[model samples]
Target: MAKYKIKINPKNLPVFDKYWHYQKSVQSPDIDVKFFRKAYKEIFDKHAVLLREDFCGTFKLCCEWVKLRERHEAIGLDLDPEPLAYGKENYYPKLNSKEKDRLVTSEQNVLTAKLKKPSDVTVAVNFSYFIFKERQVLKEYFQNVYDNLGDQGLFLLDIFGGSDIFDLPEEETEFEDENFSYYWDQEDYNPILNHGLFHIHFKRKGEKKRKNVFNYDWRVWSIAEVRDILTEVGFAETRCYWEGTDKDGEGDGEFKPSEKGEAHCESFVAYVAGIKK
Candidate 1:
């Protein structure tokens, strides 16, 4: 066997280490909670309350969202049931009755899911909407979101791309603390349509490297394409919140609205907000 420049943690830990160790540790729910509050209060002056998380795998954010207020309610919709069960076992158990009562998880497709009442804030983070590879399909999903919004509501989602994102074969990231190196393998990319295949692998020090821990076949949609779709969906206005990097040139986990961004290393993340009419 040969070794690459990276190693991934195998997630063999008996107690469901994949979500907590890999996803939750790196994910910043504090940032999410903050943005949801700011974006809501900024628009409706503390009137927004109900939140819907589309493609809410595991609904981790939903668990955190309800904690923001006793009155706050969250609805998480996703096609997959595994993560939802895991959230029930791990995150849901940790919350009190009132908090747990405020959260709702539905195992349904996001495109077809219906909200009893219009949501004040709805989000599709981690670029989950990338599953829709075609422009029309993506626009329909955005339109669904727009229709599901309350008066003065907001639709938010994250997008990331750079010169490096396209035309790249593979890239590796090393995390020494966890004794693993994460790989963002860009197996293929199409310049004509900006579609691609991506995989995540992990290598543990002195252990056999794990390949394809997770795989994603995404469209690699651009900011312009997404912005255009939001407008087509009849959103009154749209905004992009670019991320700031720290002194070490790593994502500082902070996002602020901006019109322009500078180029960066292998990968990056940011949010696109659509204001409902």
Candidate 2:
């Protein structure tokens, strides 16, 4: 056997930033803030000033919310310190003084944290609430949200489902311009319990793929079940906003309040708003 040595260049090495990659692939906080404002206005015929983000990993949405308007204020609550610290270091410095004054992040659990003032709008997006695998636990969390909201508050949640959600195969998406790829890997699913294990992987150009950069152990809850739980938690009314499809049958990213949803699609994403009167 011939002996061989490989030369490694530090300058050429890629910086594998999991949070940066996750933000690129998963989050659209700017657009989401606008949507939240529009949805709140449409439902209540008034602009919302305060937003509470639950399970707010990295709290990017809270930072964006304050920047959306002069009067807007936001609070982000999450139990995890790692993402909170990331937000403080990466996203916090980008905000203006006024925006910084309006935005706050707390290391607190959504199920038990107490808010000094009730929020006009609260969101648990990115399906973060799916972490609660049991129906009772989910309901308890919803009740907590209900209790933390103002008299005319709105609770918004994003959900995804379809025929192919269960037993979903690992899917890879390439960002050619960014020179990286993102992978959604579904490790396992239990149909009876609707519980699933999922992971996110990333691969930089000319580098080996990074496995399990992020992982999720969640119970897939249906829109109907979520609505029922909201009702049980004392929300006066619940509404579904279904996404519109493009000419090619892909999601067009325009969501509208819909009485009915397309059921035959292999995958779908929608929002459910719970109104507290």
Candidate 3:
């Protein structure tokens, strides 16, 4: 019998697109939009139509929001042009003509942008507001949101913390099916200031690890502090949604409004809703 060998083509291999990988590993925009809509309805007993996404890096949630309802509209505000452009190139094309018409993006600072219309709901997720380390600055941003919302509007924000988050220097998640791994690196943390430096790294199969693809310098604000600030910013009411644990003692991804949260959780994620009356 003759010996035979198989040949491989470079074009057949998957291209390394960092944004694609980041979305797959970090974001669940489809679910997030549903949560936002549900939370709004639960509080106000009416459907929300317009949403504003702040620090919306690619605005994936905005795209998902419009897809949820024919009447829905979304405006994404971000200071960085790079991600905004990427979203236009990649995510925008996926929408139909009508859906495309309902979505908008602006390369402007969330703090200073003049919104022409009031939003039914506004969101700052992924702890993006943590970039505002100062209490007064964050309050100013919250006040901006409060002012931009329509009557009975809602503002939602996601926050994360736990004992393990501070102690863990780095954590890696492998996507075996995708042939890549994602890393969350905690480079430094200041106890006195409550400031932390974090980075996201990715490694494709058979490739060397890429470091610091995304960097975040943040002040880790507690849930109580965030609620207090929301109250200070003139939100009529503030609510907390705590994540439930699964049978395996891991986060189950279901967040329900709760007055008290688990005190001894090693790592946890939750949302804060500020409502304007």
Candidate 4:
């Protein structure tokens, strides 16, 4: 693994933020906020005014949520202070006075953090919850979420699985406009435990690849397993929102309620929503 380096030369005049690049390449906070707001209304027959973003890196979703409605408020929780500080410095400055006041972030663990008030919606997206590899611990975390949600609150999670992720040990994606390439490196996997060790690497043009910018040791849970856990944790019902396929048979970015999923064609992403009674 190469160490991170900055080209300290007059020739390289532009400054860059790797986190910004990561968000642009992989995250769609705008779309996420839209879906959450709309889904809440459709599911509960009422608008959701409060959202709690678990494992919210950079709290981008929190920033977006406050922007959706003046009455909306958001809280973001993460154990790391680095990204939280980054959000305070970069993303927070972009918010107006009202939005800034509505968005709050805390450096705390998801399992034990105390919210000022119960949340109307709790979201753990991007497979961040996979860090809890143990079934008991994952259920405990879900239970904590359930305990903190208001009546009829929803819990949302995004998950991915398919033949492609299992077959490939490593995959690379290039973003020409961003001038960087991202790599997903699977170092090892245990079939017996369904555990995997993975790392994220990045390389800018004309520079050495920076390895292990982010690493995850995750236990990939199936949809059925997750739904069962949510149910056990006191969610009255659960539903899956499967992504639609485009002409090329790739995910088209539109997700809708599904009882059955599309055929497993190498890879897929889906959202699971747990509704509180």
Candidate 5:
């Protein structure tokens, strides 16, 4: 009797395209559209006529912001040219003539980027500002936003936390019809240094998962710390909004005002708003 060997064959495996997988695995412009509209109206009691999106990758929000109203105009700023190009090719072409004229983007640093005047609202989402670890540096960024705001303007940022972030890996919510899965890889955590390293990975159902598609070096800043810095940087009022959980004890994607927070398991998302004086 001959011994049989089991072989892993590449020809039989599903081919996962990097860019295609990323495009299909992530993105929900409608959610940002809803959040931006609600957030803008919350601050101004009316739809914001102008918006500035800092550190905008692909600028899905900016495109949606412009489509919300005829008078609405949006400026998206990002350092990388790749996502900018992707937005131009994929998202921009999908816009109408009027919306196209209303939406404009530039490749630049968030610190130096400025709008015509202080916009009605300026947003920094995706926790991109975590790159600034130092308090003073973060304050400087917020102060710039304070200086660039129109009267009664608001600066919005989203933050994530939970005890589980100390040193652990987590999976992202899976979307139907998408053939990939996302992973948040937390490699190390330093309580003293407040340093954390994270990576984004993707897995296709029938293929081996791809690792480290994107990596980040960020400091997990607390809400208190962020609020303190925002106030010190010249914001008149800083408010934190806690996310609401459904009966299943999962986030419902709706965030409401809450100054006080309760301790939860390994994860949470919150919004921090700073009112420009």
Candidate 6:
């Protein structure tokens, strides 16, 4: 009897799209819209007409903003071409002509980008500004945002912190419907500098794990410290929006302005908004 060899066919293997996976797992554009708009109305007692999204990977937030109202406009700024191209090809095409005209994006740095008009709101979420580990650089970036905002404008950013962030080595989240697993690997941390190395990896079902889908070298900034820097950089006032907890102690998806945060959680995410005088 002849022995037959078992073959592994490449065509039958699983495929992974990191950006697609990231949007599903991490971003909630609809929620961001509600928060941004509501926060604006609460702070300034008026509607925000234009928004600028700094370090806006894929510009999904900008796309969503234009959809909110006919007069609403959005601008997205980023230095990378790959994600910008990805947004142009994927998300931009989904918008109608009116929204397409209302939304604009540029391949430029947040620190020096020039816009035709100042934005009513500028957002840098997902801890993207943590890239500026130095206090001076971060303050400089904040000052630029301050100078570029319209009167009564606001700058919003999201940050995560807790005792566990420094201690947790790694975390894995599985999406059964998407047929993949996401991993956040905290490879290194320096207590002295408050800096950390993080990597995002993905594993498709029945496939080998992919490493370093995204990587970040960031200094973990405290909420208090960030507020101080915003004030020092010329923001008239700084506010924190703390997320409420459900019965199970998980974030209940509602954020209200608060000066004091709740006690003792493994990790928490909150928004800090800087109001221009």
Clashing pairs in 6: none
C-alpha lDDT (0 to 100) for residue 101 of candidate 4: 90
lDDT of 3 by residue, 24-136 (tens): 88999999999999999989999999999999988899999999999999999999887887788778889999999999998888888778899999999889999999999
Each candidate's number of clashing pairs is 5, 0, 0, 0, 0, 0
Candidate 6, which ten residues in sequence have the lowest lDDT sum? 1-10
What is candidate 1's TM-score against the reference? Answer: 0.87
Put down candidate 4 lDDT per residue, 1-277, tens digits, no spaces: 1123323457766555667767876789989999998888999899999999999988999999999898999999999887887788778889999999999998889988888799999999889999999999999999999999999899999998877666646788999987899888888777788887888888889989988888899998888899999999999999999999889877888889998886655778899999997
Worst 10 residues of 5 by lDDT: 1-10
Worst 10 residues of 4 by lDDT: 1-10
- lDDT tens per residue, model 6, 1-277: 1222223469864345567878987889878987999999898999999999999988999999999988899999999887887788779889999999999998898888888899999999889999999999999899889988998999999999887877856889999997889898989889999999999998888889999999999999999999999999888999999999899889999999898886676789999999996
Cα lDDT for residue 183, candidate 4: 88
Ranking by TM-score: 2, 3, 6, 4, 5, 1
Least lDDT summed over 10 consecutive residues: which range in candidate 1?
A: 1-10
Q: Is candidate 1 or candidate 4 better by TM-score?
A: 4
Candidate 5: the clashing residue pairs are none
lDDT of each: 0.80, 0.91, 0.91, 0.88, 0.79, 0.89
RMSD of each: 5.9, 6.1, 6.8, 3.3, 7.8, 6.8
Clashing residue pairs for model 4: none
Q: Which stretches of candidate 6 lie over 4 Å from their true place?
A: 1-15
Ranking by lDDT: 2, 3, 6, 4, 1, 5
Residue-by-residue lDDT tens digits, candidate 2, 136-186: 999999999999999999999999888877657799999999999999998
Give Cα distance to truth, residue 165, candidate 1, Å. 1.3
lDDT of 1 by residue, 7-35 (tens): 34477444324555446334666569778
